[model samples]
Target: MKEKWESYPSSIRLLAIAAIIFSTGMACIWPLVTIYIHDYLGKPLTVAGFLLLLNQGAFLIGSVAGGMLFDRWGKMRTIILSSAGIIAMSTSLGFTDDFTLYTIFFLLNGLFYGTLSPVINALAVVLWPEGGRKGLNMIYVAQNAGVAAGSALGGVLASVSFAWTFFGNAITQVIVLVLFAVMLPRYVKSLALKPQSPEMPAQEAGKAEMLLSQPAPAKKVVWGALLMLCAGLLISWIVYVQWTTVLSAYMQSLGISLRQYSFLWTINGGLILFGQPLIAWVISRFARTLKAQMLLGSYVFVLSMLILSQTTSYTGFVAAMFVMTLGEMLVWPAVPAVAAEYTPEGQEGFIQGLVSGTGSAGRMLGPLLGAFIFQTFQAEGLLYIMAGLALLSVLFFALHSSFQKGSHRVPVQTAEKL
Candidate 1:
């Protein structure tokens, strides 16, 4: 274990840290961008909504592309190129004034951002073949920490000047880009010489070698479950994404300042930092039956959204966000972890990419759904739609659990063969 942890090259470590910083800056823009478009760009909320959707759509494309590239070109190169792309896109956005042009840049930004998951995961596994889960979780903590910081900072910067927020993000991206370019090569080279751990049996090693020798077949069951999980996750995220998108407008409509709005994100981040470890520990204790935890978390998420919809004051809103984030802390990490578990050996990159791509698709759909509902009926209507979706997700998950239970059987014959 000591050797496994120590095997990670300093370059990979530096790159991971840089990635976290870049992600933090990227996240900072989410909550503020809606207001920036409405007040500064003179665009309609629907147009802003479309721009947000476009960003995630671009990310979906990028993720698919990134996964394929990672499999072929290697992980370090992908990270370097992606980070550079983000830097260029973000910097260009600062200079552009046209709403259409800004939307285009945002799409490019999403594409670059999409490269992160596969590359990061691949690097983690390569660096610590025996400690994939622990390493990945650590990386996740870093990533989420950056996100929380970015969300909070974006709100504060938006209050001072929206331009400053964009510019600051651009600068942070550039620094990370430079840092990654210098550091990644060194890390990759250093880690390349480490021997594969003894934990991998010769047969499993042969299987991996065989996989690398030929193209992978797409598994139907895996794909089907992925689709279903994506649908459920999309509805769940729409509820959360609202906090950064429509919810900001809704809160402002109720007379909340941007500063107060930003602070809520800080609270959300703090809660995640504190709550995620506990949630992870709890999940570990019941790792054999994650479906139940998933269902419970989804139900809690629904209740929290319902509570959020009823809030008339800032305090009430904050309280509701707390409850909602608690559910989120429980659900978010589990989704990816479960995806990783179900992924076939030697197809980690493809499966992780699919998971991220599906997530991007959900993100694209969430805001559009939220904005349309908000526009048609009211914010209350938006919450109702989310609540209904969440409840439906709960039902689907429950049915899925039952189906798995009924189908599950001890494969005595297969066990004997093994």
Candidate 2:
């Protein structure tokens, strides 16, 4: 196992570690935010909700800016600066007693986290180009693991004191900051000067062949595909986030306990971690191309929502969650991986940022949209609408993939590569 672990590239290993640490800290804070503001700080629930929305808005802006910086300001410098801000903001939150100061610190933390996310993803692509989607997938898995760990840890700490939870978030970030400062610069240097081996899979080689054989894609064609990808991600998240936002209330109305709803996420996190190898096999065998993976995932999402619309039993909800988790496993990472493929020479970071920012847009919109629908039409109407939006997302992905059909005039093997 040790030898197997070392066989992977150093950059991949380090990035995975950083993702787990950063996400764990993030999980610690986010799940407790509304509770802290309402119960401890004496704010209304609506104010807390609004603050969360603003925090997400800040993150959306930071994602775009971070991507541009990654392209122009240099990856190492951008990463270090973002990490510093994250550490400082989180640490400030630990000591903050005033609601206004806490809100400002919270927004800054979101901004820094948003900045950090895309940079890490872009770095995964650049540092391990040969690894293809595997690098991105690894980071995704690490993040889910962090969420599981941090949520459990945060809950325990919050039971003791909210201050401890804040401190815990800062402590994890401090470790991440130290790791970035000490180890990441070497990889950044290597990125500039190193000429590494091409350890890509045969499928990736074929994809490379297809790209090389074609004339440089017209800017319009490239943008068409990229914008479609962004649109797909945005719609997909808008529907997907319903599980977190509105579904909990829907389930409770049917008499499902809060613990049971929480357990659904526990199942999600568990499957994402332990079900990776099986999921990878399914992807390799059935969905060889990124397009296929995404479409299949989108269809699965539709199925989940359809089932959810009728599901009143806890067992039924559990089944739907299981299916939903499988779908997201395919869809989420593939978005960034696909975006990486269409990236221009110097705009890799920005493309990734664009993707992340678009997803943030979806997250920001999802709850409000779902709530409006639910208020007017109730649970069944909202679920069906979510399903329809998911299908629309599938359309965007299919249209995006269509633009690349010209480039994919290669042999079957080449077409199979993503």
Candidate 3:
């Protein structure tokens, strides 16, 4: 276990730390923003929902722009520019009571925030080409840790004064900027200028050999797979967002307390931190191929939704959540790593950005769709819908098939294979 943690390069390790800190600050506002805007500010839920959509919409644009900048200029330059812009914008909009000002601030913040996230993921690709899945999984763990930390703290501060939540977000973003400023030239810049090695861990050596043995498929085939994967990822996230939006009302309808509902996320985050390394190791040991790992996760995701559709007891919900967390941990990291693998080397930042953009697309749409379903038909209805969507996602992933050895590999005489 210790060795597994130690396997990632220092760049990825620092990137994970940066992700945790960034997510911590983000969580400070994300989980509470709707409640504060709707309940405290006396806006309708619809208004709150639209604002959330606007933020994500802006974020999607930022993600695309950021990725292009990363590829064209360089990672360090793009990261510094994006981070500094976000900091400056957020600071200027400090502690505003005006709803219009708040809305604009959120839109701008989302754009800059969107840019930063993909760049960070791109950095992971640059730092650990061989350990793609492990690098992303570690970053995912750090992000969840930040979520757990910030959620708990945000609740406390929001109760005292809402201003503190924004203050917390701004201050932490400043710290992120500082870290990047200090570390970029020495770490990220050096990695970028040096050529990347295609080495794999011993356990994955056979699969790597097989990939090299085969004839490279057409570039069109590689791109088609990535596009489909992006669509599948978007669908998965739409269902995932239910846990934040409509799930609260679902729990309350079942006579579950808010505290109990919150505890489910606590369990979700705790399990990821402790269980992710072992899960990553298992994937490396057995799954090896990205397709197999994603298939395993997609099936688990379907199972989780099916469980949610029927369970009335608290224990059943907890069990379902555990399964759901496992599914996400398996699927999310694998997607980006595979995207990196399929990407045509120099365009990695753009590819990862496209992946992040799809995620933002889901976040933008999920809440609106989820809220409508929840209010119209309630928990059972919503769960059923989610289960069906997840099933489709599973099918979407099955389209291109596995990255297994033997037939999966093209003959090396033809060209290099993924």
**lDDT: which candidate is best?**
2
Native-to-model Cα distance after best TM-score fit, residue 5 in candidate 3, in Å: 3.4
Misplaced by over 4 Å in model 3 are 1-3, 192-219, 281-286, 373-378, 401-418
State residue 48's C-alpha deviation in candidate 3, in Å: 1.2
- The most accurate candidate by TM-score is 2
Q: How does each model score on lDDT?
A: 0.69, 0.85, 0.79
Off by over 4 Å in 1: 1-16, 35-45, 98-100, 129-133, 151-167, 174-218, 252-260, 280-292, 309-313, 374-384, 395-418
- Pairs with backbone N, CA or C atoms under 3 Å apart (clashes), candidate 3: 214-409, 214-410, 214-411, 215-410, 215-411
Clashing pairs in 1: 28-150
lDDT, residue 242, model 1: 78
**Winner of 1 and 3 under TM-score:** 3
> How does candidate 1 fare on TM-score?
0.76
lDDT digits (tens) for residues 31-114 of candidate 1: 677778989899997787777777788888888888767756666577677877877787787778888788888888888888
What TM-score does each of the candidates earn?
0.76, 0.90, 0.86
- The full ranking of all candidates by TM-score, starting with the best, is 2, 3, 1
Which model is ahead, 1 or 3, in terms of lDDT? 3
lDDT of 2 by residue, 1-418 (tens): 4774587698889988988998899899889999999999999989998998999899999999999998888777788788889878978887888999999999998998899889878888877776778888888898999999999889998999898888888889888878777766787666656532379788887887776666655667667888888898898899889998888888888899999899999999999999987788989898999899999899989999999888789999999999999999999999999877767656767888888899889989999999999999989999899899889989999999767544321111211000
